[model samples]
Target chain A: MSETDARPGYFGRFGGQFVPEALSGAITQLEEAWRDAEADPTFGLELDRLRSQYGGRPTPLYLAERLSEEAGLEVHLKREDLAHTGSHKLNNVVGQALLTTRMGKPRVIAETGAGQHGVATATAAALFGLECVVYMGAEDCRRQRLNVVRMQLLGAEVVPVESGTRTLKDAINEAMRDWVTNVDSTHYLIGSAMGPHPFPLIVRELQKVISVESKAQFAAQAGGLPDAVIACVGGGSNAIGSFAEFIDEPDVQLVGVEAAGEGIGTGRTAATITEGREAVLHGARSIALVDEDGQVKHAHSISAGLDYPGVGPEHAMLADSGRGRYVAATDREAIQGFRRLSELEGIIPALEPSHAIGWLLAHGRDELDAGATVILTVSGRGDKDVDEVVKVMTELGIAGDLGNEVVDADPREDPESDA
Target chain B: MSAVTDAFTRARDEGRAALVIYLPAGFPDMETSRACLEAAADSGADVLEVGFPFSDPMMDGPIIQAASQQALDHGYGVADDLDMCRSLTGEVDVPALVMTYVTIPDTRGFARFADEAAGAGLAGAILPDLPAGESDPWVREARRTGLDTVFLASSVSTDDRIDRIAEVSTGFVYAVGLMGVTGVKDVASDDSRTLVERIRSRTSTPVAVGLGVKTRQQAAEVASFADGVIVGSAVVQAASDGEPAGAAHRVADLVRELRAGVGSR
Candidate 1:
C-alpha cells in the first residue's frame, strides 16, 4: 500500500506516537514543523543547496566490472560511501539540523551505534552552531573508537551509556531519556527511518536523495532502471532511501540484507525480518527479536551498525506486503565480501554494506537473469573498521591471505629482520 | 461505580487525597515484593499499582528501571503480575491496578488481557505509552470487562488533549507532576496544580499527580489540589533497603508517613 493510504502517523498498523505523555507536545510540534517545511519551497531549496554544497549529494553510480563479472550480472555501485562524513548519514542529519534551526531549538541529541551517524550529527551541529550531545553504547564506544574521537573532534559531547545490553538499543533508550528530560530546548536528531510517526517519514524524505539521484543518473548512464536495488538494513535508513523511489515500480526489485552474526537460528543474529516477531521497541511497532513474553532480545552482529533488535516500521510493512525481499549474510561472508571488494574494486566498504555485497555474491546469479542490472549501495567507507577487521582476521588465522588459506608460519623469515 | 472510583470517593468523604503506592511485581523477588505490597496495604494505602516489568521501559526513571530489570532478570511475566494482583486483591482491602506499557497487553491480545485482569480482581489499568488518541481497542475491551482505564495528562498537554484524555479516562486522570519520567524530584512543580484544575474543569474524574511526588511535604502539597497522590520510586527504594521483613517494615513506615501527609491536607 502507498503511504498516502495509511492513517496519519501510521503505516499499516505499524507506526504510531507510542511515547510518554511528556513528549506529546514536542512530537506534535515536530509534525507541524515538518508539514510546514514540506509545503514551503524555500525549505526544499535550502536542503538541496546543503546536499549539493555541504553533503556532496549526487554521489556517483559506478560500474564495478570485476565484481560484476564475479556476480554474473551488471553490478553498479551507488557510492554513498563518498558522501560527507563517509556515509549517507550526512543527508538525514543535515536536514534535521536545519529542522532544529527551523523549530528554534538550541540543542540537539542523538543516539549512535557504529558512530557514523554520531560523526555526521556532530558535523552538522558544528556547521549549524547548535549544542550537540550524542549517546553511544559503551561497548560501541570501545568497538568503534576512532568514530568516537571523530565525534569529539567535531565538538560533540559523547556520553557512553552503560545500560541494558550496552548497545544500540540501550543507547537509544538513554537518548530518549535525555530527550524526555529536555524536550523543550532540544530536538532529537534521530538517525534512522524508525521511531515514532514524523521521525520515520522525515528521515525517509531526508535520505530519499539516494534513490532520487540514482534513478535519474541510471537513466542517463544506462538508459533504464536496474532490475534490482540492494542495500544493508539496520534501522533501514539507507536502504529505505535507496528503495523509496523504486517502491512503486513493480519491475524494480528491492532487497534489504540484514546481519546474521552466526546464523538466523543460532540466537546470535540481527536478522530482524527473518527471525523476529512483531513487537514494540524504541517507539514503533515493528518486527523485532522478541522472546515469548514480548521482551526484546539482544541482537549480535560483527557490524556494529546492524547490531540492533529492530528494523524500521516501514520496512516491516514492505516485507509483509511482499513489496521488498529481505535476506541475511553471515559474519564470515561479510568479511569475505569486505576483502573481495577491496581487491577487485579498490574500495574498502564498511562492514554494514558488506552484507549487501556478500548477499549479491552468494545469491545474485541464482536470483536474477544473466545480464540483469543491479544497483547495490555501499553505504559507508571502511576506514573506521580496519582495526576491528584486522583483529577478527587475525583470530581466524587468515590475516594476510587473500583467500581462506591459513598460514601457520610467521611471514617474517627472522624475528629481528625488521630491526 | 468501579472499585477505583469508590476508593477516590471514600477518600473525598474523609477529606483527604487517596494514597497510591506503585511497586513492580517480583522485584527483588516474588515473596519480598508481595510482602512489601501487603505491608503498604496494611499501613494505609488506598490503591496499589502493580507494575508489570517490560524489557524496554521508556517512561521510567533509573530506580524503577533498575527494579524492572531485576524483575525481568528473575523471569517475571504477565502471568506473575496477574497472580500477584489476584493474591493482593484477595488478601487486602485496597483496590489494585496493573501498570505497564501497552505492548504487553497488545501482544497478548487486548480482550484476553482485560478479561484476565478482571478475573484477577484488578480494578483498572494504566498504560503510560498508550495515549488517548490510540486507546480505542484497549478501552473497548476494558469497558467490556468492567475495568477502569487511566490515561495520563502532562503539564505540557494542550487543553484540547486534556479534554480528550479526561473524557476517555475512567478511574482518574494521571496528572504528571513534571515534564519527565517516573522519579523522585526535590519538589513537585507548580504546573501540576494548573493541570489538575484543567482536568477538573473538563471532567469530574479524580486527578492524581505522580512523577516526582517523593516526600511527605511534597505529598501534602500535591494533596491540596489533586484528589490522589501517587508515589513509586521512593517506595521501591525503601523496599530495596533491607531484608524482606525489614523491607516490609520500612515500607509500612513510609506508607504510614505518606498516609498522614495526604490526610494532613
Candidate 2:
C-alpha cells in the first residue's frame, strides 16, 4: 500500500473517517497511539510474544490433499481455526487489547455478528484485566447463543442491540454510540479491517501476521510461493490479512469469496464487493449493499459473521485497482463446503471461510491452472456453527445426503412465518 | 449573509438565542412531517432543520433513530427531503436547512446534490458525520451552490480543530452539548457552556448547542450561553407521542415552550 493510502485513511477514494465529531478526539488519539506503537520495537516484541505464547501463532499451513484432489489443484489451508478463541479474530483483539492498555484506556467496547469477534475480544479483555462490553444484534444473540454465552463467560457484558435490522450493522451502530459516549475512558476495539482510517490500518497490520507467516511457511513447505491466496471477505479482515503480505507480489492472485446468501439476484446477500455500490457505511467509504437512493440495505447470510452490508474500504480499493478478484458463494454452496471440509480434511471450518472453500470447489479449475497451488485461510473453526448447520440441513431436506444436488432454498425465508 | 446566518443574526439582534427545531422529513409520513415543520415554523422557530432519514443514523439516539427508521419505511428519499425543504421554506418565513448523514449527498454526487438542494430553496445543510478534515470537497460543492455548510464541534474538540471547523463553517458552528448522540438528557451539560466559550474565543461565528436539549428548562439553560439552542429528539418525541391527529399541535406546543424558554434568557 502507498503511504498516501495509509495516511488519513483514504485508499484510492474509498476510506476516510466519516464519524461524528464526538468521537474525533478519540480517533485522533488512537491514530497517534497506533503510529507510536508501530514505530516502537518493544510494541512489536510484546505483540509477537502475545501471538506465539497466547494466540498460538505460526498456525500451520497444511496441504489438504483430499480437498486438493476435489478442487483439481493443490490446496493448502492456513489454519487460523487453530488460533485461540477458535478464529482468526483473536489476532485482532489481542493487538487492540494491548493498544487499549498502551493508550491507558481501562474499558473496551466492540460489535459482533457471529460473536467470534466478541468472544475473541472478551477473551483478550479477560487476559488483560480490562473491562469489556460487546454489542450484538438481538437477532444474532438468538442465532449465536453459544458464542453469546462464551462472551458472558469470558466476563464481557453483551448488549443485544434491538434497533435497525437487529444484526451486525445495528450492533456496529450501537457500539459506535457507546464509544462516542464513553470515549474518554473506553476504546472501541473494532473487529474488522473496516470502519474509519486507523481501524482498517490497525486491524490489517495486526492480522497481517497470517500472510507474514504463511508466505514463509508456504515457501519452505512447497518449495515456492502459491499461485493464489484465497479467503472469505466479511468486512475483509481475514481476507486482507491472508492477502496483505502477498499484495505486493504480482503473480499471486488474491481471491476474496463473499457470501451470496441465497443468491445475489434474490436481493438477499452479503456479497458487498460483488453486488454492492460505492457508499459510506459505519464510518468509512466502502462498497455497501444500498438501495438506488443510497440507503444501506439489510445483508443476509447463513453465517452471521458474513452478514454485513459493507466490505472493508481497502477491498474496494483493491478491487478497483484489479489487485484483487472477488467472487460469491451461496448458502447451499457454503454448507456443502462446510460439510466437505469436515469430511475430507477432518476440519470443521467456520461458515465465513467455507465460502472460500465453496467458491474454490465450484470455480477453482476455471480460475487456476490444473496443478497450480492455492493457499486458503480457514478463518475459524466451526464448532459454533454445528447446531445451525444441522438445522439448515434438515430444513433443506439434505440432512443425510452429502451427494445431493444444490438446493434452491432461500435460507432467509421463514417457512414457519408463512405457515 | 446566507439565510441561516441571517436567521442567527436576526435572533441575536432580537436579544435572544435562535430556536432551531429539527424534524425528520417524511417521519410517520410525509404529510404529517410537513405539518409538524409548519407548526414548528409558525410557533416561533427561527430556523427549521428538515432531517433526511437514513438507514443507519449512528450519531442519533433512540428517538431520532426510530423516527428515521419510520421515515425510511415510508419510502422517504433525498428528493422527498428536498421537496419538504422547498415547501417549508416557501410556506413559512423561517430558514430551512437539510440535516442528514454525508453518504446520502455523497452518493447522489456532492455537486449535484448541492445544486438540487439549493434549487429546492434549502438554506444549507448540517452533516453531523462530516468533520472539517474531510469536508473540503463538500465545502467546495456547497460553496459553489451558494449553500451554507454547518459543521459540528464537540466538547472534546481541541482549539486547533475548533478553528478549522469555524473557518469552514458558513452557517453557525454546531456545538454538540454533550459527548453523546442526539437525545434528551435530564441535566444540561456545563461542558457545552465551556465549549461555546472556547469556540467564541477562537472565532466570531455564531455557535448553536445541540444533541441533548429536550425540555424548556434545558433549552433556556443552553440559550443562556449559546447563540442557538437546537431541539431534535424531543420534538420528534412530541410528534410521535399520542395520536397522529394531534401531532402537529403537540409539536407546535413544544416548540412554543422551547421558544419561550430561549427568549427568557
Candidate 3:
C-alpha cells in the first residue's frame, strides 16, 4: 500500500493487470483513465463534492471512551456506520457508481453476500437513474430479506442466484455472467477488494479515502497517528482501507482481526488471513483458508458480513510479508464485544467491527503499546445485526450478563507490546 | 460411431435417450471426480461434458455451483481442471468435451487453451458464455488447434442468431430448452415443444436440449423434441448423491426409460 519503493504499480505482487485478453484493452484504458483521474485536480474536487452531497462523506470519528475502558484498550471508533445506507460499503459503491456513470455505462450489475452492497448499488443506480441488476444468492436472499426488499424498492432487479454454494461467491459468479453478457451497456460494480487483479487494487484505492481521513482526524484529535490500527476483514475493504495509509509508518502497528466463529480450532472460522496461506479463493490469489486439498472451505461467522472464505490478495501478501499481524476472535467473543460497546460506550458496533473488539478482548491488551492509541474502525452500525446478536447472546446464556461483563472488562489492561 | 457425435446418432436411431453427464474436473478432487465421470460413462452414459472449472461460471445452477465449489475446495481450479480434461482421454474414449465460458479462454489466450484442450485429448470445447455474434474471432482462433468450437443456442434465439450459431458450430448445437438458469423446475410446456421445433427447422446441426430436464420422466418426455436430451442437472444431482455410482446406475436406468419413451413415440 505504501507508494514509496512501489514496484511500478504493483501492490506487493498481489496487484497487477492480470486481465483477460478481451479486457486488456479496457483495462489499459481504465488504468490510463484512473491515472489521469488521480492526477486531475478537478476529478478529486468533483468526487469530493459528490462524496459530500451524495455519499455523505466524513461520517464521524467518535471516541468510544466507555467501550475502550471496557476493552482495556483506547478504542476510538471511525464511524463509517454513519455513511449513507448504513455502512462503509457506500464508500466504494459511490466511487464505482460515479465512475460507471462517467464511463458512459447506463446499466450496472453487482454481486452481494449480505445484500448490503446490493442495496447500496441499487441506491446508486436509483440515484443515477441507471438500470441495475443485483445478483444475490438464494441463501443470502433468505437470510437478508430486508436488503432484498430494499434493493427492489430502489428499482434494482434482484436476481436470486441458486448457484454454487448459494452464497456470496455464487452471487459474484452470477454477476460476472451478467457482466460478460451485458458488458456492452453495463459495468460490473464489484463490492469488495477480493476479485481478480486490478479489482483488489481498485477497491482498495477507492477505499483509501477512509484511512486518509481517519489519519487526519486522529492527528487532529489525539495529537498524532494511532499506535495501532484495527479493522475487521471480510474481503478486507475497511481493514485494507485503513491499513493502506499507515502501512509504511514504521512506528505504527497494523492489526487485522478475523472471525473465528466458535473457535479457531473448530474449522468454522472466517480467519482466512490468519489461518490461510497463498492461494486463490474467489478469483484473487490471496491468503485463503483452503482445506488440505486446496478448495475454499466453508467460512463460519456469527455475522453474515464477515463470513467470506478469503481475504483480499493484497492483505494476504501484506500478512505474508509481516507488514501486519492477522488474528482471530470467536463468535462468543465478538458478541460479547458487541454488547460491551453498546453498554459501555452507548454505541452498537456492527458485528464485523465487533470482531476487532473480540480479538482485543481475547488477547489481553498487555501486548499493545502502553498508553499507545489503538484506533478501530467501526465500519458500520449494529442495526442489521441486532437480532442475530440477540440470538447468539441467548445461545451463549449471556443475554442479561452483558451489563456485568462490560463493567469488568478491560480492553487495554495488558497494553499491546511492540513484540 | 464417431465418439460423441456417434453417441448422438446411435441414440437417435435406437430411439433411446443419450445421457451426456457433466462433471467439473474436480468435485472434491480431480481423481474422485474423474472416477465419478467414469462411473457415469461406465454406467452407459452416451457422452460426457467434463467441465473445465473457471473461477466464474455464470450460466450454471446451484448444483453445478456446489460441484464447482467442491472442485475449488479440492484444489481443482482452471489449471487443475484442464489437467483433468487431458487425463479423460487416457481414461475413456467416450468423446469428452470441456465446457467453459469464454472469458477464461480469453485470459489464457483462446488459441493456447484450444491447443491445450486438443492436447489433453479433448474432443472439442463448448463455451456457453460466448455470444453467437462474437464467436467468429475466438472460435476462429480456437479452431486453429483442430478443437471443434461448440456454440450454444437458446429457446429464445431468433432465426438470425440460430443461423449464425449453426454456421460456426461444428460438433453440436447446445439447445437450451428454457429461458432460465440451470437446475430450475422444467415443466414441459407448449413453449418448450415449439422452441425445439423452431431450432430444428433453422439448422442442420444436431440440437441437444439442456436445462431443467432432471427426472427420467422429464428426460424421456423431452427427448421427443430434439435429437438429444442433454441431461445435466439430473446427472449432477445423482452424481453428487451419497452413492455416486449407484446414482449413476439410476441415471442409466432413466436413460433406458427415456430411450423406450422415444422409441414408442
The DockQ leader among the candidates is 2
Position A138, candidate 2: lDDT: 96
Fnat values, one per model, are: 0.55, 0.76, 0.08
Arranged by TM-score, best first: 1, 2, 3
lDDT string for model 2 (A13-41, tens) is: 88899999888899899999998998999
Compute the interface RMSD for each candidate structure: 1.2, 0.9, 8.7
Q: Clashing residue pairs in candidate 2, if any?
A: none
Model 2 iRMSD vs. native: 0.9
lDDT of each: 0.91, 0.91, 0.72
Model 2 chain A TM-score equals 0.94
| Segments of candidate 3 deviating more than 4 angstroms | A1-10, A15-33, A401-419, B1-49, B52-265
lDDT by residue for model 3 (A53-149), tens: 9888887676777767665777778888888888888878877777777778899999887778888899989888899999988877877777888
Better of 2 and 3 by DockQ: 2
The TM-score of predicted model 2 comes to 0.96
- Reference-based lDDT, residue A250, model 1: 95
Query: Which model scores highest in lDDT?
Result: 2
Q: Write the per-residue lDDT of candidate 1 for residues A1-419, one digit (tens) a residue.
A: 34657778777877888888889999999999998899999999999999999888889999999999998999999999999999999999998998899999999999999999999999999999999999999999999999999999999999998878889999998899888889999999999999988899999998899999999988998888999999999999999999999999999999999999988899999999999988777788788898866778899998999999999999999999999999999888898899899989999999999999998998888987898999999999999998888888887777775333545557587778767
